[model samples]
Target: MNDDTVTATPAAPAAEPESMPAPEQPAATGPGTPDPADPATPGSRRLLRAGAATAAAALVGVAIGIGIIKTQYDDPAPATAAAPSTAPTPTASATPYGAKSNGSHFGSLRDLLLPVPAGYRPGPDDGVYGNDTELNGEQLSAELDAELQQIPKDKRDKLRSYWEGLHVKATGVRTYLSTGDDLVIGLKLRQFNQQEVQRINEYTAVFTGDTGLFRIGPSIPGHPEAHCYLMPAPPSAPIDYLECSAAEGDLLVIMNAEGVAPLPKDKIVALFTLQLDRLARPGASA
Candidate 1:
C-alpha cells in the first residue's frame, strides 16, 4: 500500500510555486552613458543635482519677476489740490419797468427810476412837486422827519441855498422797495435851462465825516462828474442812505436811497449812472 501510494504521489503533478514579478531592467546605454541606477556614478549625480538647481533657479526667477510686477502696481498715486464769489447778481428787469432806458416816459418820476433791485416790485410814492426854490427844502423836509437829518442844521440850510437861485421845475418821487428788508428811493428831478445847469456846477457843500450814529458820506464811484454821498444807517429807522446830485443839460438830478443798498459800490454807481442815462435821453424827461 505504501509502494502504491508513493507511485501515485509521484504520478501526481509536481506542485507549482507562486509566480514572482521580474526585476525592472536597467536601460541599455552607449559606451559613454552613465547608468541611472548606479548611485556611485559622479557624472550622473552631478547632472541630477545641476538639473534640480536649475529648476530651483527658474522658480526663484519667476517669483522675483512677480515681486517686481507687484511692486510697480502697488505704488501710490500723487497727492496737492483752488476758493469759491460773493457779489449780488441782479437779474435783468421786467419788461415795462426795465424799459426806461429806451427813452420812454414812465408816466411819473416814480415810475422812471429803479425802486429796488431788478427782481423786486416798486412801492408807494410819497413826495411833492414844485420849482427848485420851493421844492428844495420845505417839501423834502415835510416828506421826511426832521430828526432824520444827521447833518448839522447849518449844513442842511447851506444845502438849501444851492437851489435858491437855480431856475428849474421839479417833481420829487419817493417810494419804498421790499428787499430782504425795505428801502426808500427818492429822486428829485429839476428840468431847466443852461443857467440852472451852470448853477449846479457852481455849488459845493461840506461833509464833516462826524463819528456818532452818523457816518460821513463816501463818494459814490463812477461819478467823476456828480456829487454823491452815502449816509449812515438810521437807528431803528430801518434804512441807510445815499444821495447823488448831478446836472446834465436841462436837468438837475438828485438821486437818494434810504437803505444800506444791497449792492457793491461799483454796481450801485453803475445803476445810478444808468438811471441818469435814461433821464437824459431825448423825449424821456425825468
Candidate 2:
C-alpha cells in the first residue's frame, strides 16, 4: 500500500588496479656528444655528416618546388558563389513520449493524472476535503522527517542523505468509486529528480517480485516500463486489490484498486494505459 518501500539500490563498483610509477623519459643526446652508453666511431661521424648534407640539399629542393607552385597560383581566378544546398536544415529531435526536452512534465502534476472514467464518481476523501490531494517539496520533506523522528540519529542521518539525493519535488493523489461495483480506485503521482526515476522503477519491481499474496498484475500495452500487481484476498479477508506502478519521465505513477473478489484486471490495465498516454502527450490528452 506504500510506494515508500521502494529504495535506492546502488550497484557495487569494480576494484581498480594499484597505481604504478611511470618510467623516466630517456635523457636527450646532444649534437656534439655521442651518447656515452654507445660512443660513436670516426667513420660513423663521417657518415652522419654526409647524411646531414643530403638532408639540407633536399630541403633546398623542396623550397624551390614550393616557389614554382606558388607562382602558378599567383594570378588567382575570379571567385564564384557557392550553390545553395538542397538538403533540408535539421530540426531538434522530438522529445521522448512528447514530454519536455528536459524529460519532466510542463505544468501541474495533478493535471497529468488520468481523468475519471464515465461510470466512476469521486471516491471518499482520505485527506482534507476533496478526492484529490497534493504535497509540495517542503511538505514531503517534513512528513519524512516526522516519520524518521523515532529512529536512531545515525540511521536517520543516512536515510535523510538518501532522501536528499532523490530531490523529491511534489506528489498528487486522486481517488474514484465505481457506481456499479463499489470498487475504489486510487491514483498517486510522485515527482522527483529525473535521474532517479528509473532507479525507483527498478526498486519497485524488485520489492514486488515473488512475495507472498502478490503476483504480477498485468502488462500495460505499448509500455514495457510499466507494470501491474495483484494481491488476492485471503480466506479470512473479503476484499481483493490491484496495484500498478510506472516511472513516467520524472514522475512515478501509482494506482490501486480494491473491491470484491475477482477484481477486474483488464479495467485496471486500461485505466493505467490511459494515464500513461495522457502523460506521453499532455496537449493532445487535454
Query: Could you say which candidate leads in lDDT?
Result: 2
- Positional deviation of residue 101's Cα in model 1 after best superposition, in angstroms: 18
**Model 1: CA > 4 A from native:** 1-117, 127-165, 172-176, 201-222, 232-239, 260-267, 281-286
Candidate 2: TM-score?
A: 0.62
Query: Model 1, residue 234: what's the lDDT?
Result: 24
Model 1 Cα lDDT, one tens digit per residue, 40-149: 21111111111111111111111111111122223222110000012222334543432334323333344454444573344333211211112433443343233225
Residue 195, model 1: Cα distance from true site in angstroms: 2.8
| Candidate 2: pairs in clash | none
Whole-model Cα lDDT of every candidate shown, in order? 0.33, 0.50
Q: What is the lDDT of residue 135 in candidate 1?
A: 40
RMSD of each: 51.1, 34.3
lDDT of 2 by residue, 263-285 (tens): 67777777778888877734433
* Model 2 alpha-carbon drift over 4 Å, by segment: 1-98, 127-130, 210-213, 235-237, 281-286
